[model samples]
Target: MMIIKEPKELQQELKRRRFEAAKQGRELTVGLVPTMGYLHEGHASLIRKARANDVVVLSIFVNPIQFGPNEDLDRYPRDAARDLALAEKECVDIVFMPEVQHMYPQPTKTKIQVEGLTSSLCGASRPGHFDGVTTVVAKLFHITKPDFAYFGMKDAQQVAVLSQMVADLNMDVQLVPCPIVRESDGMALSSRNVYLNEEQRSQALVLSASLKEAYELVQEQKSTTAAELKKLLTERIEAKPLAEIDYVEVLTFPELEPISEQTRLSDYEGDIIAALAVKFGSTRLIDNMLFQKKDVALHV
Candidate 1:
């Protein structure tokens, strides 16, 4: 994989990638996967599939504008050399690791906003997080103008928000959402996995287990209300000594508006999504599952 560090050099590389493909009279499908510097298996899975099907353009930019006042921008782990090494193994054709200043100019003010869905899930706790994410991803998309962009399903609400943003903005790219990569235990894999101490690691299972219970509740045909299910999740998540429940709520999919009424699968086109956010130690984690009313009705 070629590492393009300079902005002008990267643009020249992109033009070369475009011209080389055009010479063969073949449509070059470039799949763009955006990430912060530190890379992991979860990110590799996205790139692997992108490489199998298209020219993979992986970007590593630890965006600062996205970080809030008290957030972990200063402390977020970063290792560019390690990230580039992994990108090569993943069959990524081009890795664009831009400096923080290259990604943002002084006196920049514009931002990208995804309505409704961003207001809930992790959005509720981290103010302006999605705005930063959407804006940076938007800038990358414009610069590379890839045929497809990929993301992991572990960030369920982010997938929903980006899907909405692309449709709304009429951007000419397919946003591919891949499944989440999990630990042998049920905990979802994340960059923040580094923060968990031995005890905190064991306690973190409660978050996933609580979501499991919520699904079980829906399975038992117990009166399935979003509120009671969320309550069950909150209680289980907070059982850990250092864990704190940020928000655990059942939301209707796509719109992601919090569900208040008794929602039936038939009513929602089989697109209801359960999402939650929790803080363990100083790290915040989010996870969700997409389900249909049919899945609830068929519970064994």
Candidate 2:
């Protein structure tokens, strides 16, 4: 595996081989797994998914533009050395760990919006967060031009938005969605897990617990109604002292147009994604679960 610090260095390195490969009439199948630096088991899960296919290229750049002024950018957990060591262990082909300046030059103006999908949930809280995410991911897609891209379902909205942009704009890469990785305690693993205090940490369980409650309720065929499910999860999380519910929305997968009411199995079509974002003290964490209606679809 190679560590590329500069964008030009990465582009320069890719150019030589891309040309050579293009000349031979061979289409290179590459997979890109994008992440912020603080590598955890959840991140490893993404790497494992990418490595299972063709050449896996991971980009580790903790985007500042994505962070709100009040959000934790400076305090955000990052260890490139730690991340690189972990990536090497996973046999990642190339680790594109670029600096901030290398990613975005002075006073960036333009942003990418996938429309409709990003305005709710995490977007409701972190305004322009998805724009930054989409912009960067789109840039990455253009830079690497991978055959497919991998992202954890933990950031369901971002995935949906990016997927939409790709579909709408007809981008050439396939979006490979992966399942959410969790800790034994049911907390969905995130890089921000490091910020949790002893007390705040315990309160964070309410987020997943509420989701679990929804899952269990729906599984029992008791209350699959969206309002009932949303309310059920919302009240439980609000009961926690440290937790503040940013948005407990249940939506249709791929499109993310908040489905406030889901009853019959037919109503919740294709893959269903349940996503939630909560704040513990000043830090925010997001997690989601992907429910497939085909094989593992819940029924009594």
Candidate 3:
């Protein structure tokens, strides 16, 4: 796999590939998987999906802009050699690992914000977090210019914000949302999982378990009220001694508007996402599940 550090070099390579494919009388499909460096099975799942394209580029830049002042920026995580090995194993064609300076040689003034979508959930807690995410992702899309970009459903809000940005701005890339990859015990795999101690790790199961309970409530019991669902989730996490609730929200998909108490589950068509962020010690983790009324009714 080729390791590209400079933006210009990466752009030049992509242009060359495009030209070569055009010369062969065929169109090239490039898939991009943007990440913040600590490679895991979740990232590998994205890589595997990207492998379907003729050219796959995996970016491993730990974006400083996306992190807040009090957030784990300096100590997020990094293992370049390990990440490169994983990229190679996943058959990735190019790994773009750019330095902060390389990405922002001289940042003056430019921020991409997805407005309403960023106003709630993790956005409410983190503040300017989604703005940083959208800005860097927009930069990456412009530099990589891939035909398709892949993201995990584990970050349901991130996916929602970026998807809106793509549509609103008329970006050329197709955003591909992949399923969440979780551990056997149901904790959604995250790079930050390394920060969890043995005890904290065990307690962390509450995040997923709470979502599972919410799913059962809606799918099995046909419980349609958002208030009851959020209440159940909040209580489930608060019961875990190590877990501290950050946010428990049930909202409509894509739109991401709050599910009103008046809105019945059976009456709402399309997808609904139950997302939450909780802290097990100082390590903050997030997870979400997507539900469709038809699928829920069928199980009932």
Candidate 4:
């Protein structure tokens, strides 16, 4: 496995590989698994999915642009030795680890924004966050030239936003969203989970618990309105003293259109996501469960 830091060199190397593969009368399908390091089972799941492609290119850059001023940019987490070892273990052909200077080089003059979709959920709380995500992912798409890019559904909003960006811009790469990898106890895996203290770590299970409750509620047809479900999720999370609510919302999937507080779940013909973001002490975590509406019944 090759660990490439320079952008031009990586791009040229990919070009050469493509030419060589074509000359040998072989079709090469590159799969990209983009990540901000501190590898975990969640990231490993994405890498495993990418293994289906002819070539897997894992890009490990802690993107500076996506972070807000108050965010954990400096102390996000980094262990290059471990990340490289995991990349090799995953059988990734190329690992792109670019520095901020290599990715930015100079001040970024342009930004990519998907309107309407960015108006709610995590986007509402973290302003300009998706813009940075789209910009960087676009650059990776250009550099890797992957036929498919794997992303975990743990970041459902990110999956939706990036999918829109790909379609709107007519990008050739196909996005493959894998399932959310959870701990046996049910907390969604995140690099930031490392920051959680003992008590905070236990309290973090409320996130997955709330989502599971929401899922059961929807499946049983006990909760009908968006407001009813959101209230249940809020109350469940608030029960844990350490849990602080960020946003609890039930919105249409992909479009991310908000469901009216009094609107019946059956009134929505398509799928909807029950998503919440909460802070456990200084660490903030997000979780969601998607439900598909069928007649008066909703299935998870």
User: In order, how many clashes per candidate?
Assistant: 0, 0, 0, 0
What ranges in model 4 sit over 4 Å off?
A: 293-300
User: If candidate 4 were superposed on the true structure by all CA atoms, what would the RMSD be?
Assistant: 2.2
Instruction: Kindly list the per-residue Cα lDDT of model 4 for residues 205-263, writing each as its tens digit.
Output: 98888788777776678446889888888898989999889998999998899878987
User: Which of candidates 2 and 4 reaches a greater lDDT?
Assistant: 4
Q: Cα miss at 213, model 4 (Å)?
A: 1.2
lDDT of all the models against the reference?
0.79, 0.79, 0.89, 0.89
Give the deviation of candidate 2 from the true structure as CA RMSD.
Answer: 2.6
- Model 4 clash pairs are none
Alpha-carbon runs more than 4 Å astray in model 1: 220-223, 264-267, 293-300
Question: What are the RMSD figures for all models against the true structure?
Answer: 2.7, 2.6, 2.0, 2.2
Clashing pairs in 3: none
Relative to the true structure, candidate 4 reaches a TM of 0.95
Q: For candidate 3, lDDT tens digit of each residue in 1-300?
A: 999999999999999999999999989989999999889999999999998899999999988887889999999889999999999999999999999999999983899988899999989999989999999999999899999999988888999999999999999999999888888888899999999999999998988888887878776666558888888888988888998888888899878998787666766787888888999889999998788755642110
Best by TM-score: 3
Residues 224-246 of candidate 2: C-alpha lDDT, one tens digit per residue: 67777777877888888788767
lDDT of 1 by residue, 167-220 (tens): 999999899888777776778888887877888888888866776777777667
lDDT of 3 at 19: 93
State which candidate, 1 or 3, has the greater lDDT: 3
